[model samples]
Target: MFWKDKYEVGVELIDNQHKELFNRVEDFLKVIRSTTLGEKKAQKVNETLEFMKAYVVEHFRDEEEYQLKIGYPDYEKHKQIHDNMVSFVLEVSEEYEKSGYNDALIQKFAGRLLTWLINHVAAEDQKIADYAAKREGI
Candidate 1:
Protein backbone atom coordinates (compact mmCIF):
# COMPACT_ATOMS: atom_id res chain seq x y z
CA MET A 1 0.00 0.00 0.00
CA PHE A 2 1.09 3.56 -0.69
CA TRP A 3 1.26 6.22 1.99
CA LYS A 4 -0.61 9.35 1.14
CA ASP A 5 -0.02 12.75 2.69
CA LYS A 6 -3.63 12.80 3.81
CA TYR A 7 -2.83 9.96 6.20
CA GLU A 8 -0.71 12.27 8.32
CA VAL A 9 -2.17 13.02 11.75
CA GLY A 10 0.10 16.00 12.62
CA VAL A 11 2.09 13.63 14.80
CA GLU A 12 5.58 13.35 13.38
CA LEU A 13 6.65 10.14 15.08
CA ILE A 14 3.43 8.27 14.40
CA ASP A 15 3.22 9.59 10.87
CA ASN A 16 6.75 8.42 10.12
CA GLN A 17 6.02 5.00 11.51
CA HIS A 18 2.83 4.80 9.47
CA LYS A 19 4.73 5.73 6.33
CA GLU A 20 7.33 3.09 7.02
CA LEU A 21 4.59 0.54 7.51
CA PHE A 22 2.98 1.42 4.20
CA ASN A 23 6.34 1.17 2.47
CA ARG A 24 7.04 -2.22 3.98
CA VAL A 25 3.61 -3.51 3.12
CA GLU A 26 3.98 -2.23 -0.41
CA ASP A 27 7.33 -3.95 -0.73
CA PHE A 28 5.71 -7.12 0.55
CA LEU A 29 2.94 -6.91 -2.01
CA LYS A 30 5.52 -6.43 -4.72
CA VAL A 31 7.32 -9.59 -3.68
CA ILE A 32 4.08 -11.53 -3.63
CA ARG A 33 3.09 -10.23 -7.06
CA SER A 34 6.48 -10.84 -8.62
CA THR A 35 6.72 -13.30 -11.51
CA THR A 36 9.28 -15.41 -9.69
CA LEU A 37 8.03 -18.10 -7.34
CA GLY A 38 9.35 -20.75 -4.99
CA GLU A 39 12.58 -20.00 -3.12
CA LYS A 40 13.20 -16.55 -4.59
CA LYS A 41 9.80 -15.13 -3.78
CA ALA A 42 9.61 -17.03 -0.55
CA GLN A 43 12.85 -15.44 0.61
CA LYS A 44 11.48 -11.93 0.24
CA VAL A 45 8.14 -12.93 1.69
CA ASN A 46 9.81 -14.45 4.74
CA GLU A 47 11.89 -11.32 5.25
CA THR A 48 8.84 -9.07 5.05
CA LEU A 49 6.84 -11.32 7.35
CA GLU A 50 9.59 -11.26 9.94
CA PHE A 51 9.79 -7.48 9.73
CA MET A 52 6.05 -7.14 10.10
CA LYS A 53 6.01 -9.42 13.12
CA ALA A 54 8.39 -7.17 15.01
CA TYR A 55 7.60 -3.76 13.55
CA VAL A 56 3.89 -4.06 14.14
CA VAL A 57 4.30 -4.59 17.86
CA GLU A 58 6.62 -1.63 18.13
CA HIS A 59 4.31 0.59 16.11
CA PHE A 60 1.27 -0.41 18.11
CA ARG A 61 3.07 0.35 21.32
CA ASP A 62 3.97 3.80 20.10
CA GLU A 63 0.48 4.45 18.82
CA GLU A 64 -1.03 3.34 22.08
CA GLU A 65 1.34 5.62 23.94
CA TYR A 66 0.15 8.49 21.79
CA GLN A 67 -3.43 7.60 22.58
CA LEU A 68 -2.74 7.57 26.28
CA LYS A 69 -0.87 10.85 26.15
CA ILE A 70 -3.78 12.52 24.45
CA GLY A 71 -6.26 11.00 26.87
CA TYR A 72 -7.99 9.33 23.99
CA PRO A 73 -11.16 7.81 25.43
CA ASP A 74 -11.12 4.87 23.06
CA TYR A 75 -7.75 3.62 24.18
CA GLU A 76 -9.07 0.23 25.29
CA LYS A 77 -10.97 -0.34 22.10
CA HIS A 78 -8.01 0.80 20.05
CA LYS A 79 -5.77 -1.56 21.96
CA GLN A 80 -8.10 -4.44 21.31
CA ILE A 81 -7.79 -3.79 17.61
CA HIS A 82 -4.02 -3.97 17.84
CA ASP A 83 -4.19 -7.09 19.98
CA ASN A 84 -6.45 -8.82 17.49
CA MET A 85 -4.07 -8.05 14.65
CA VAL A 86 -1.13 -9.38 16.63
CA SER A 87 -3.02 -12.56 17.34
CA PHE A 88 -4.03 -12.97 13.73
CA VAL A 89 -0.46 -12.53 12.56
CA LEU A 90 0.86 -15.07 15.04
CA GLU A 91 -1.85 -17.56 14.14
CA VAL A 92 -1.26 -17.17 10.43
CA SER A 93 2.49 -17.49 10.88
CA GLU A 94 2.02 -20.72 12.81
CA GLU A 95 -0.38 -22.10 10.23
CA TYR A 96 1.96 -21.14 7.42
CA GLU A 97 4.79 -22.98 9.10
CA LYS A 98 2.64 -26.06 9.71
CA SER A 99 1.44 -26.07 6.14
CA GLY A 100 5.01 -26.26 4.88
CA TYR A 101 5.09 -22.65 3.67
CA ASN A 102 1.99 -22.97 1.57
CA ASP A 103 1.67 -20.28 -1.11
CA ALA A 104 -2.07 -20.01 -0.74
CA LEU A 105 -1.77 -19.27 2.95
CA ILE A 106 0.75 -16.53 2.31
CA GLN A 107 -1.43 -15.01 -0.38
CA LYS A 108 -4.41 -14.91 1.90
CA PHE A 109 -2.32 -13.43 4.69
CA ALA A 110 -1.02 -10.67 2.42
CA GLY A 111 -4.49 -9.80 1.19
CA ARG A 112 -5.81 -9.53 4.71
CA LEU A 113 -2.83 -7.47 5.84
CA LEU A 114 -3.41 -5.00 3.03
CA THR A 115 -7.05 -4.57 3.87
CA TRP A 116 -6.47 -4.45 7.62
CA LEU A 117 -3.69 -1.88 7.44
CA ILE A 118 -5.69 0.40 5.20
CA ASN A 119 -8.77 0.31 7.37
CA HIS A 120 -6.84 0.61 10.60
CA VAL A 121 -5.04 3.73 9.45
CA ALA A 122 -7.78 5.28 7.42
CA ALA A 123 -10.66 4.58 9.78
CA GLU A 124 -9.45 3.59 13.23
CA ASP A 125 -6.30 5.66 13.57
CA GLN A 126 -8.06 8.69 12.24
CA LYS A 127 -10.36 8.62 15.23
CA ILE A 128 -7.38 8.97 17.52
CA ALA A 129 -6.11 11.86 15.43
CA ASP A 130 -9.47 13.55 15.58
CA TYR A 131 -9.51 13.26 19.33
CA ALA A 132 -6.04 14.71 19.61
CA ALA A 133 -6.88 17.55 17.30
CA LYS A 134 -9.95 18.51 19.27
CA ARG A 135 -8.08 18.45 22.55
CA GLU A 136 -5.19 20.46 21.16
CA GLY A 137 -7.48 22.91 19.42
CA ILE A 138 -5.62 22.27 16.18
Candidate 2:
Protein backbone atom coordinates (compact mmCIF):
# COMPACT_ATOMS: atom_id res chain seq x y z
CA MET A 1 0.00 0.00 0.00
CA PHE A 2 1.02 3.56 -0.61
CA TRP A 3 2.17 5.78 2.26
CA LYS A 4 0.15 8.94 1.94
CA ASP A 5 1.19 12.30 3.37
CA LYS A 6 -1.95 12.25 5.44
CA TYR A 7 -0.46 9.45 7.47
CA GLU A 8 2.10 11.81 8.95
CA VAL A 9 1.49 12.64 12.60
CA GLY A 10 3.51 15.86 12.84
CA VAL A 11 6.19 13.80 14.51
CA GLU A 12 9.23 13.62 12.28
CA LEU A 13 10.70 10.50 13.82
CA ILE A 14 7.46 8.61 13.79
CA ASP A 15 6.59 9.73 10.29
CA ASN A 16 9.97 8.66 8.96
CA GLN A 17 9.65 5.31 10.64
CA HIS A 18 6.19 4.87 9.11
CA LYS A 19 7.53 5.65 5.66
CA GLU A 20 10.37 3.17 6.13
CA LEU A 21 7.83 0.64 7.26
CA PHE A 22 5.88 1.07 4.05
CA ASN A 23 9.03 0.66 1.99
CA ARG A 24 10.05 -2.50 3.80
CA VAL A 25 6.59 -3.95 3.47
CA GLU A 26 6.56 -3.12 -0.21
CA ASP A 27 9.87 -4.93 -0.57
CA PHE A 28 8.37 -7.92 1.19
CA LEU A 29 5.49 -7.89 -1.27
CA LYS A 30 7.82 -7.71 -4.25
CA VAL A 31 9.85 -10.63 -2.97
CA ILE A 32 6.72 -12.66 -2.58
CA ARG A 33 5.44 -11.82 -6.04
CA SER A 34 8.76 -12.17 -7.84
CA THR A 35 9.20 -15.09 -10.24
CA THR A 36 12.85 -15.73 -9.41
CA LEU A 37 12.05 -19.34 -8.43
CA GLY A 38 13.91 -21.76 -6.12
CA GLU A 39 16.23 -20.77 -3.35
CA LYS A 40 16.56 -17.18 -4.55
CA LYS A 41 12.94 -16.43 -3.73
CA ALA A 42 13.12 -18.28 -0.47
CA GLN A 43 16.25 -16.35 0.47
CA LYS A 44 14.58 -13.01 -0.01
CA VAL A 45 11.53 -14.15 1.91
CA ASN A 46 13.72 -15.33 4.76
CA GLU A 47 15.58 -12.04 4.84
CA THR A 48 12.38 -10.01 4.93
CA LEU A 49 10.92 -12.24 7.61
CA GLU A 50 14.00 -11.77 9.77
CA PHE A 51 13.94 -8.01 9.32
CA MET A 52 10.24 -7.77 10.09
CA LYS A 53 10.43 -9.84 13.23
CA ALA A 54 12.56 -7.25 15.00
CA TYR A 55 11.52 -4.17 13.07
CA VAL A 56 7.86 -4.58 13.85
CA VAL A 57 8.46 -4.79 17.59
CA GLU A 58 10.68 -1.75 17.48
CA HIS A 59 8.15 0.26 15.56
CA PHE A 60 5.33 -0.71 17.87
CA ARG A 61 7.36 0.24 20.92
CA ASP A 62 8.14 3.65 19.50
CA GLU A 63 4.57 4.18 18.47
CA GLU A 64 3.23 3.22 21.83
CA GLU A 65 5.67 5.53 23.54
CA TYR A 66 4.49 8.36 21.35
CA GLN A 67 0.92 7.64 22.29
CA LEU A 68 1.78 7.67 25.97
CA LYS A 69 3.77 10.86 25.65
CA ILE A 70 0.77 12.66 24.28
CA GLY A 71 -1.49 11.28 26.99
CA TYR A 72 -3.80 9.79 24.40
CA PRO A 73 -6.91 8.56 26.16
CA ASP A 74 -6.87 5.39 24.15
CA TYR A 75 -3.26 4.57 24.93
CA GLU A 76 -4.14 1.41 26.80
CA LYS A 77 -6.37 0.06 24.08
CA HIS A 78 -3.95 1.03 21.33
CA LYS A 79 -1.17 -0.76 23.18
CA GLN A 80 -3.32 -3.82 23.42
CA ILE A 81 -3.75 -3.81 19.66
CA HIS A 82 -0.01 -3.55 19.15
CA ASP A 83 0.58 -6.37 21.61
CA ASN A 84 -1.91 -8.60 19.84
CA MET A 85 -0.35 -7.96 16.43
CA VAL A 86 3.12 -8.67 17.76
CA SER A 87 1.93 -11.89 19.30
CA PHE A 88 0.42 -12.98 16.02
CA VAL A 89 3.61 -12.17 14.14
CA LEU A 90 5.78 -14.11 16.55
CA GLU A 91 3.45 -17.09 16.51
CA VAL A 92 3.35 -17.19 12.74
CA SER A 93 7.08 -16.73 12.47
CA GLU A 94 7.68 -19.66 14.77
CA GLU A 95 5.27 -21.85 12.84
CA TYR A 96 6.73 -20.82 9.52
CA GLU A 97 10.23 -21.71 10.67
CA LYS A 98 9.11 -24.97 12.24
CA SER A 99 7.48 -25.98 9.01
CA GLY A 100 10.74 -25.40 7.14
CA TYR A 101 9.86 -22.02 5.76
CA ASN A 102 6.49 -22.94 4.40
CA ASP A 103 5.51 -20.83 1.44
CA ALA A 104 1.85 -20.75 2.28
CA LEU A 105 2.57 -19.54 5.81
CA ILE A 106 4.64 -16.57 4.71
CA GLN A 107 2.18 -15.76 1.95
CA LYS A 108 -0.59 -15.70 4.47
CA PHE A 109 1.56 -13.56 6.74
CA ALA A 110 2.28 -10.99 4.04
CA GLY A 111 -1.40 -10.70 3.19
CA ARG A 112 -2.46 -10.28 6.80
CA LEU A 113 0.39 -7.95 7.57
CA LEU A 114 -0.55 -5.73 4.67
CA THR A 115 -4.15 -5.54 5.75
CA TRP A 116 -3.31 -4.97 9.41
CA LEU A 117 -0.78 -2.24 8.74
CA ILE A 118 -3.06 -0.37 6.40
CA ASN A 119 -6.07 -0.57 8.66
CA HIS A 120 -4.10 0.20 11.81
CA VAL A 121 -2.42 3.24 10.33
CA ALA A 122 -5.38 4.54 8.40
CA ALA A 123 -7.93 4.01 11.10
CA GLU A 124 -6.63 3.30 14.61
CA ASP A 125 -3.50 5.40 14.26
CA GLN A 126 -5.29 8.37 12.79
CA LYS A 127 -6.97 8.87 16.13
CA ILE A 128 -3.64 9.53 17.77
CA ALA A 129 -2.78 12.05 15.09
CA ASP A 130 -6.09 13.74 15.53
CA TYR A 131 -5.64 13.93 19.25
CA ALA A 132 -2.18 15.36 18.93
CA ALA A 133 -3.32 17.94 16.45
CA LYS A 134 -6.24 19.04 18.53
CA ARG A 135 -4.04 19.33 21.57
CA GLU A 136 -1.61 21.54 19.70
CA GLY A 137 -4.31 23.63 18.02
CA ILE A 138 -3.04 22.49 14.66
Candidate 3:
Protein backbone atom coordinates (compact mmCIF):
# COMPACT_ATOMS: atom_id res chain seq x y z
CA MET A 1 0.00 0.00 0.00
CA PHE A 2 2.97 2.33 0.44
CA TRP A 3 3.75 2.05 -3.23
CA LYS A 4 2.45 4.64 -5.68
CA ASP A 5 2.36 4.62 -9.47
CA LYS A 6 4.53 7.71 -9.32
CA TYR A 7 7.33 5.68 -7.82
CA GLU A 8 7.46 3.08 -10.58
CA VAL A 9 10.91 2.99 -12.24
CA GLY A 10 9.76 0.90 -15.25
CA VAL A 11 11.90 -1.93 -14.02
CA GLU A 12 9.94 -4.95 -12.91
CA LEU A 13 12.50 -6.44 -10.54
CA ILE A 14 13.36 -3.16 -8.85
CA ASP A 15 9.75 -2.14 -8.56
CA ASN A 16 8.87 -5.46 -6.95
CA GLN A 17 11.76 -5.09 -4.57
CA HIS A 18 10.58 -1.62 -3.68
CA LYS A 19 7.14 -3.00 -2.86
CA GLU A 20 8.68 -5.72 -0.70
CA LEU A 21 10.77 -3.12 1.09
CA PHE A 22 7.70 -1.06 1.77
CA ASN A 23 5.89 -4.12 3.08
CA ARG A 24 8.75 -4.91 5.40
CA VAL A 25 8.84 -1.34 6.66
CA GLU A 26 5.14 -1.52 7.38
CA ASP A 27 5.65 -4.73 9.30
CA PHE A 28 8.46 -3.11 11.25
CA LEU A 29 6.27 -0.16 12.11
CA LYS A 30 3.55 -2.49 13.38
CA VAL A 31 6.01 -4.28 15.59
CA ILE A 32 7.34 -0.99 16.86
CA ARG A 33 3.91 0.15 17.95
CA SER A 34 2.96 -3.13 19.53
CA THR A 35 2.99 -3.45 23.31
CA THR A 36 4.18 -7.03 23.37
CA LEU A 37 6.10 -7.90 26.51
CA GLY A 38 9.37 -9.74 27.07
CA GLU A 39 11.50 -11.62 24.56
CA LYS A 40 8.76 -11.84 21.93
CA LYS A 41 9.06 -8.10 21.43
CA ALA A 42 12.80 -8.22 21.14
CA GLN A 43 12.62 -11.14 18.74
CA LYS A 44 10.32 -9.38 16.34
CA VAL A 45 12.37 -6.19 16.39
CA ASN A 46 15.58 -8.09 15.82
CA GLU A 47 14.11 -9.98 12.89
CA THR A 48 12.97 -6.83 11.15
CA LEU A 49 16.28 -5.11 11.76
CA GLU A 50 18.24 -8.00 10.30
CA PHE A 51 15.96 -8.21 7.29
CA MET A 52 16.35 -4.53 6.46
CA LYS A 53 20.12 -4.57 6.76
CA ALA A 54 20.45 -7.44 4.32
CA TYR A 55 17.62 -6.60 1.93
CA VAL A 56 18.66 -2.99 1.42
CA VAL A 57 22.16 -4.01 0.41
CA GLU A 58 20.84 -6.55 -2.06
CA HIS A 59 18.26 -4.19 -3.50
CA PHE A 60 20.80 -1.40 -3.97
CA ARG A 61 23.18 -3.75 -5.73
CA ASP A 62 20.51 -4.86 -8.16
CA GLU A 63 19.41 -1.29 -8.82
CA GLU A 64 22.96 -0.16 -9.47
CA GLU A 65 23.47 -3.03 -11.88
CA TYR A 66 20.39 -2.01 -13.81
CA GLN A 67 21.63 1.57 -14.00
CA LEU A 68 24.94 0.36 -15.37
CA LYS A 69 23.21 -1.85 -17.92
CA ILE A 70 21.39 1.13 -19.35
CA GLY A 71 24.47 3.35 -19.13
CA TYR A 72 22.75 5.83 -16.89
CA PRO A 73 24.92 8.98 -16.90
CA ASP A 74 24.31 9.58 -13.25
CA TYR A 75 25.09 6.05 -12.20
CA GLU A 76 28.12 7.08 -10.17
CA LYS A 77 26.20 9.67 -8.23
CA HIS A 78 23.37 7.25 -7.65
CA LYS A 79 25.74 4.61 -6.39
CA GLN A 80 27.20 7.16 -3.99
CA ILE A 81 23.72 7.73 -2.62
CA HIS A 82 23.28 4.00 -2.20
CA ASP A 83 26.60 3.73 -0.38
CA ASN A 84 25.66 6.53 1.98
CA MET A 85 22.39 4.81 2.86
CA VAL A 86 24.19 1.53 3.47
CA SER A 87 26.67 3.27 5.72
CA PHE A 88 23.90 4.97 7.64
CA VAL A 89 22.05 1.68 8.08
CA LEU A 90 25.17 -0.02 9.36
CA GLU A 91 25.91 2.81 11.76
CA VAL A 92 22.42 2.67 13.17
CA SER A 93 22.50 -1.09 13.41
CA GLU A 94 25.70 -0.86 15.38
CA GLU A 95 24.25 1.75 17.68
CA TYR A 96 21.10 -0.34 18.15
CA GLU A 97 23.15 -3.35 19.12
CA LYS A 98 25.38 -1.37 21.44
CA SER A 99 22.43 0.28 23.12
CA GLY A 100 20.83 -3.08 23.86
CA TYR A 101 18.28 -2.92 21.03
CA ASN A 102 16.83 0.38 22.05
CA ASP A 103 13.44 1.14 20.54
CA ALA A 104 14.09 4.88 20.65
CA LEU A 105 17.06 4.42 18.33
CA ILE A 106 15.05 2.41 15.86
CA GLN A 107 12.19 4.90 16.03
CA LYS A 108 14.54 7.62 14.86
CA PHE A 109 15.91 5.30 12.22
CA ALA A 110 12.45 4.51 10.94
CA GLY A 111 11.60 8.16 10.53
CA ARG A 112 14.75 8.94 8.56
CA LEU A 113 14.30 5.71 6.57
CA LEU A 114 10.73 6.45 5.55
CA THR A 115 11.68 9.93 4.45
CA TRP A 116 14.69 8.74 2.46
CA LEU A 117 12.79 5.89 0.82
CA ILE A 118 9.98 8.14 -0.30
CA ASN A 119 12.30 10.76 -1.72
CA HIS A 120 14.62 8.27 -3.34
CA VAL A 121 11.92 6.29 -5.07
CA ALA A 122 9.69 9.19 -6.00
CA ALA A 123 12.44 11.53 -7.09
CA GLU A 124 15.84 9.89 -7.57
CA ASP A 125 14.71 6.57 -9.00
CA GLN A 126 12.13 8.23 -11.17
CA LYS A 127 14.96 10.04 -12.93
CA ILE A 128 16.11 6.70 -14.30
CA ALA A 129 12.67 5.92 -15.65
CA ASP A 130 12.43 9.35 -17.19
CA TYR A 131 15.76 8.90 -18.89
CA ALA A 132 14.83 5.47 -20.20
CA ALA A 133 11.53 6.73 -21.57
CA LYS A 134 13.20 9.60 -23.34
CA ARG A 135 15.84 7.24 -24.73
CA GLU A 136 13.13 5.03 -26.19
CA GLY A 137 11.32 8.06 -27.58
CA ILE A 138 8.29 7.23 -25.53
Top model by TM-score, which number?
1
- Give all TM-scores, in the order shown: 0.94, 0.92, 0.91
Error of 3 at 134 (Å): 0.8
Per-residue lDDT tens digits for candidate 3, residues 5-104, read 7798989999999999888777777777777655666776688678879999999999999998888999999999999988888888888788876777
Write model 1 residue lDDT over 1-138, tens digit each, in one string: 478887888799999999998998898888788776657777876787788889999999999998999899999999999999999898887786677567788889889999998889988999988888899896
Ten residues in sequence with the least summed lDDT for candidate 1: 36-45
Q: What overall lDDT goes with each candidate model?
A: 0.87, 0.84, 0.85
Minimal lDDT window, size 10, model 2: 35-44
Q: Alpha-carbon error at 124 in model 3, in Å?
A: 0.4
Candidate 2 local lDDT, 1-138, one digit each (tens): 578888887788878888888888888888778767667667877777787788888988898899888899999999999899888888887887788667788888889888888888888989999999898895
Highest lDDT against the true fold, candidate: 1
Q: Put the candidates in lDDT order, highest first.
A: 1, 3, 2
* Residue-level error in angstroms, candidate 3, position 44: 2.7
The TM-score, computed over Cα atoms with residue i paired to residue i, of candidate 2 is 0.92
Could you tell which candidate, 1 or 2, scores higher by TM-score?
Answer: 1
